[model samples]
Target: MAGHDLDRSLGLYPTMMISMGAMIGSGIFVLPALGYKKAGPAVILAYLVAAAVVLPAALSKAEMATAMPESGGTYLYIDRALGPLFGTIAGIGAWFSLVFKSSFALVGLGAYLLLFAPISQGAVVYVALALAVLVVALNVSGTKMSGQIQAVIVTLVVAGLLAYVVNAGFVADAGRYAPFTTHGGSGIITAAAFVFVSYAGVTKIASVAEEVKDPGKNLPRAMLGSMAIMTLLYIGVVGAIIGLSDPEVLKTGGPGGTASLTPMADGAGALLGGAGVLFISVIAVVALTSMANAGVLSSSRFPLAMSRDDLLPSSLQTIDARFKTPRNAVLLTGVVLLLLIAFVPVIELAKLASAFQILVFSFENMALVAFRVADVPSYEPEFKAPGYPFVQVFGFVAGIALLTQMGTVPILGAVGIILGSALVYVAYGRPRTDRTGAIGTILRARRGEEDDGIAATEPE
Candidate 1:
């Protein structure tokens, strides 16, 4: 596991499925209830607004990924544009956030399984851990296998959702959609902030940009395409739930603020009775498993990328000789996922994941801005993000605004991760190399000197 490169096994359709599958999980399945609680029928608008806010970051990532088409995605852009210190932070934060979110998806998988059959409480953990193993094994087997599985899962989930939306339209009572603005504009905005994390997965295709066929074209197309498709799905599904379920049943917070997380199933029960419930339950499991698989596939690349830059131990840089995958990094991420599912209350930690996603997207926009301002000659992308600096700036500001809505603990957690990564950079990464970023190139240019920094990797 030392010299092989990750195989370019993913095409446009599979890559697009990775983006869509990662996003269609617990975010739409469970959280819509909470959004409904906040904005009533107007939660549909919240989904729309959240996608609007996420669009800029998606475009920014597309532009940068086309230019650098590397495995690290957000971390790669930030490192090359801002400097290694910020890169280390972005890399570590991204890895953990993805792992946490994936672990939460596995846990959600377990919970949804319980709805299918009566499993003991302890068995849920065992079930999730088992699924984690299978997901890890799938990723370790090969990227092509993982992407293929993702394609199947996404197709099934999307087809089920589309069917549900169309069928529910026939039976759903118009009165349920009445009083749409139950909570007004402020509620819609707050719910939008809450659901912003749902769209975060759109840009994740960039993490595996190095393994995507014709990346300069496919990377942006996959990302933007998934964003558009998933946004519509979210709105449609949430609208169906709002229309099919009674208002009282859709409201969250049963006891001790524990929300009943089965609004989708309840809506299904209304649509076609017990059979509909079973169908949605099966769909939920497949969707959550898809998210977990994608998490393992993408998050593992962070360590591999960081190791290549000497931000972490070089052992992680090794690729499996047979499969050409980051075997060590995948194993390590799998271990963390198992630990999280076994002990840590990952649902609570998921808020931190959401916070980190907001931070990462903000950094992504900022990185694009930095690169464009530096005007690096080597930074030519096949597809540039339209609107340039204004889009990037709005993305950054909107990300910050969404971060504020996540509350204090999550904000502190994001800050703590940043600070700790900085410490690690100073102690471990800074001494290893004098690799400079685009900004450094600009500073050197201002001094009337030629700069020889690490902008050497040409687009794939």
Candidate 2:
């Protein structure tokens, strides 16, 4: 067998689901408490600031995506616009960032469950890892299966969020925000910087361009749709949280998104009475699952793209003969995610993921400007960033500022990873492709598998 093709079952709803699930994660509920401490009441400012920064970035991504609709998202855009080397490093970094982010998403899932199922040894990690594996299995099954699952999960997630927002009451305590700059201007800015990750999910739309139905329309629609909806929900939640209690009080409560959203349940219980927390707790679980599924859908594609380009082993590039999904890549992603949840600290990973993506986003934003200026052809994406060089540049600088605000360890670590990736590129990066080359053949086989279904057709 020599060649194959991907099953194109994903449509606009699935595309929007991918983006929605990716953005409205357990973090919004989980992180608010943390921001309460960091920025006091002013954390709201951070949320708005983060939203402002991401708006431009989203628009910029839309512009580039309209021109180049591929699986790798920014990785594909940068490589096509910049060149193989810049593209390779960017793609690797972007892929790694998602893997790390997915790892935390898994951790968040298990950790949230522990609130109700706390004391079981290895239960949390095991359960989360298992969920991740389930996602991989789903993807390997077929696009239709994956699409349905994603859409359902995303729907429940949105419903749960809207429930809390609408039911959480209107009057936010002006006192909690009294000392708006209580954490100092820098503190609120820092807290908001962290919250910025909540909006990063919108980029997931750009990551699966090849499989999206009518990418030109769906891509932009999904990007803008998810962004607008998630933003409204987020603003509502933040408003509800502040109205319910003081941010300073929340800061002292717990860690994780579940910790943050639990207050909403408490607020609801006080107003609605009895089992309120339990009701929202269930919502929390659904939200966590949604995040993991969408994440798995996105992260798996990273390795698939890398393998296709000969930067990684072609085995990872393999798709199921019948499913038209990247079987090996999905499995590999599951393995990496499991390892991260098992070993790494969640907060640290969040910071790292956020910082690294900020760097990648900065590049993407810059690429938007460069491509616009260079005037490359064939990108022809459905959406464009609007405001051209100015907005993209502004977003780029803001992202860089966030990276700096993330402090020394994360910033330095991100830089180090980029360097290490470069070194890897110097070493195993450019494996030559030839008919006799095993690696090259494997990569081609993967490409072929993506072309055909499970049954490999003999070369005609």
Candidate 3:
């Protein structure tokens, strides 16, 4: 592959913060109320279930990122393991999924904004758009500045959440535990699907692996470490919110139903009084806007990775000489984020983003399987995912099961994305290059060939 030409400025600390910042945003702050609406107080179980489902993909990605350590995390792995066609789908889907989730976080800023002032929904949209612009500019400048911002925001938010969890645990009403499983198994599983995107940001660090220092050691450490930290944090925060907040507000959540924006602020007000309200509101806004910033930084790499492989226009691969950032790719992502913030409703944004994320995750697991089965000599990962084929297979099955429970629109949307990506490959990407991946090894081995032809097409 062509060199990414990006600076290796992110260290272990900054890298971990980026992954944590991305994972802790909208999922914890906004979506718990919606999950509560579906699964009752059992939304705590839904968070647990969602974390369980996300674990395998996180493991798989850690393993792959260690071996590859390149830009376009999901896209690069899929392209090298499956082939360019599927790479196109993974690249586009991963990009849109991150963008959609980021936009959702920005839109959610309105709910917390309501606590500080009585702003109209239209005004909230404008605020979100403004934040999007700032995030895009931060990314265009350089990854170092972007990672620094994420580190500050994630550290402060995590501290606030830890304090809230501990304080709320002391005063939480025992009565809230009386009716935990109101909707039963089906409801909890469905709620899990809705909240699954909460953990989507855990794997985003892989996309910019090319820009990380000592990626072989730091990539696995950051991704796996963030996954473990966020899972516990998610469960604890959601449990506190359920125990402290009123059932009625969680159920209705304004006009948006399950997409209620300010569960953290509302629950904080109840648990710690007015002081708690102000504290959590500030943290929520900072946490979510930081997430959007990380999203811009990571998602922009997909276009750059694909363009380097001739899957997109070469212009996107242009790195700024001074800043060493993908300026065009960041700007492209910004335009899409602006349009999404302006046109889409909150619920649709969350559901669609979760759906696309699950699809990309399924492909990630399969790519790992392909690499192991092919057993390419160069495919050595310092950190291997435990359970081997079973873990990958289970991740794939769980992803499909959760997708089915996400309702009809998201299911259709995932299918449309696959078909659309295929069309783009056949029409625009096919004639540009002849590339093959690990699958070529498997096919050649079946014919008893001395060596596979993958080296001929793969870029250096």
Sort the predicted structures by lDDT, highest score first. 3, 1, 2
Per-model tally of clashing residue pairs: 0, 21, 3
lDDT tens digits, residue span 1-460, model 1 = 4445678888888888878866788788867876787787898998888887888888888778768855568888888888888889999988988988888778668767877777543456677898899999989888565455667778999999998898898888889888998889878876777677788888867656667887767877887788888888888888888888877766742222334356688668866655888899899987887678778888998999899898999998788999888899999999988997887754454567677877888888988888888888889876678888898899899888877776687789789989999999999999996767877877788898877753432322
- Cα deviation of 457, candidate 1, in Å: 8.1
Candidate 2 Cα misplacement greater than 4 A, ranges: 1-18, 118-153, 170-174, 207-226, 245-249, 255-268, 320-325, 377-382, 431-460
Q: Which residue runs does candidate 1 get wrong by more than 4 Å? A: 1-18, 120-126, 137-149, 178-186, 204-225, 246-257, 318-325, 342-347, 446-450, 454-460
- TM-scores, all models, native as reference: 0.86, 0.80, 0.90
- Model 3 residue 436 CA deviation (Å) reads 1.7
Best by TM-score: 3
In model 1, the Cα lDDT at residue 231 comes to 85
lDDT of 2 by residue, 180-255 (tens): 6676878866776677778888876665655677765776677777777777788788777777764434654444
- Model 3, 156-194: lDDT tens per residue? 899999999998998778798768888899889988998
Ranking by TM-score: 3, 1, 2
